[model samples]
Target chain A: METLKINYKNLYFPPGGILMWIIIFLELITFGMALVVFAMYGSEEPEIFHQSRLQLNSTFGAINTVFLLTSGFFMANAVVEFKAKNVKKSSFYFKLTMLGGLLFLILKSVEYYHKIDSGITLETNTFFAFYWLLTGFHLIHVIMGLVILIWTNNGMMKKNSDTEVVDVEACAAFWHMCDLIWLLLFPVLYLIF
Target chain B: MKKTLLFNYGLLILLTISTAVISNFVAIKSLAIGLIMGLSALKFMLVSFEFMELKKANLFWKVSLIFVLFLIVLSVVFISN
Candidate 1:
């Protein structure tokens, strides 16, 4: 009897799925362009950007970095636990992952509130405009990511769990995209000026 | 796989902390900026390869995504300088 072998080399199914990877690439490109433009503008008005960056709380940015990275770690472990069919372990890890995300969001919201209280807005300056738009957009992605994680976790809790590996992979991929985007944004927006 | 995941997470956390601290305490402004960007790229690659499982992905996707990062980083660094 002859057996069939699926070659992933020529196939488009990367880690999560082709469709998901496509979205990742597109989103990266969009943000990548914006970041480059931001850098260019910073060069033009280095003082304004530097002063604005100093106003940004680097401590908040650093703590958020730890939160997101920790979350991503928990998320990867959840996927591992799920793949082993250890639903209980997976559920625990999933909760931890969500907690990390929740903490990040709460912190970010507090930072945003402080910014608003101080009258920083898109119209404040070029750097502030990019800051509000880029970080705000990334925050929205994190919210969507949390929604997806909750949905998948709920699926896993059902009597007959319907969440597939691909589904979880897709979810993790989206969540990590949030992390990845934040990595780029953190250094440039908060650190580099 | 478990060991690999743990190791990746460890390196990621280490890198993140170092980047933040170095940028905070480093005396040279230009040096700090360069180091931060470089470390950020390391974080990007770690998440993509380990967490996102791009190491298991096809070469095309892996290479393309990396190239994209390189371009973005290069442009930002050049203009910032």
Candidate 2:
């Protein structure tokens, strides 16, 4: 009975703690609903969606997917290293993770530049509107995630720092959420018309 | 554990590449989209379960997350139709 109670508590808390998990779920639901609506809009005008999707540069999208996923993997390793009390290795992995994120942002900026160059702003059309809005919101999340990762890494490296395991886990959880959101966005906005 | 994580990473990259190639090259539009979405779903499950450590969570969370996303992906399939 004692073990059961402890197990229940642990489960309730999760890796990044219960509050972070709640936020993750809320974010996921919000993105999921937006995607559903995006698909509904696509169904209404397949041609516009198809044409807009063609202009999207799927190669860029695919490369970004790789970037985010690779970062996510590095993040998982960082968490593991942290758990093992290997702060140096953990910090190294965190740096690699940030590099992945930086690569993603640079490439995304180029993609956005191309869109702007071609005069494809949010007001261009329905497809472009969703493209800019959904991905724009996601970009904000990625930026926020990078800030958290840097903070977490710096704190860990500081002597006598008070950074907790749960803090790192929370940062990682948030980072992976970006990956999850992009997973949906990539296919819906880029592949499926 | 690290080995397992590395394996999952490799698999995800391969799946991502294959899904992109298949969706782009396949002749049938609906078939291509369907296959791509299905593969996307698989990739989603892989990242959530392995990388996010959802596999270590309780049954409730593990099941809820998977089922919710699966349903959302299904809705996406129907929406694209």
lDDT, candidate 1, B31-65, per-residue tens: 88888889999999999998988888889988998
The per-residue C-alpha lDDT of model 1 at residue A164 equals 77
Give candidate 2's total backbone clashes: 0
Give the i-RMS of model 2 in Å.
Answer: 1.8
The lDDT, on a scale of 0 to 1, for candidate 1 is 0.89
Interface RMSD of candidate number 1: 1.5
Expressed as tens digits, the lDDT of each residue in A35-151 for candidate 1 is: 999999999999999999999999999999999999999899988887777777988888998999999999999999999999999999999999999999999999999999999
Q: Which tens-of-lDDT digit does each residue in A158-186 have in candidate 2?
A: 98878777788889999998998899889
Backbone collision count in every prediction? 0, 0
Task: Name the regions of candidate 1 deviating beyond 4 angstroms.
Answer: A1-10
Q: Given candidate 2, what's the lDDT at residue B5?
A: 93
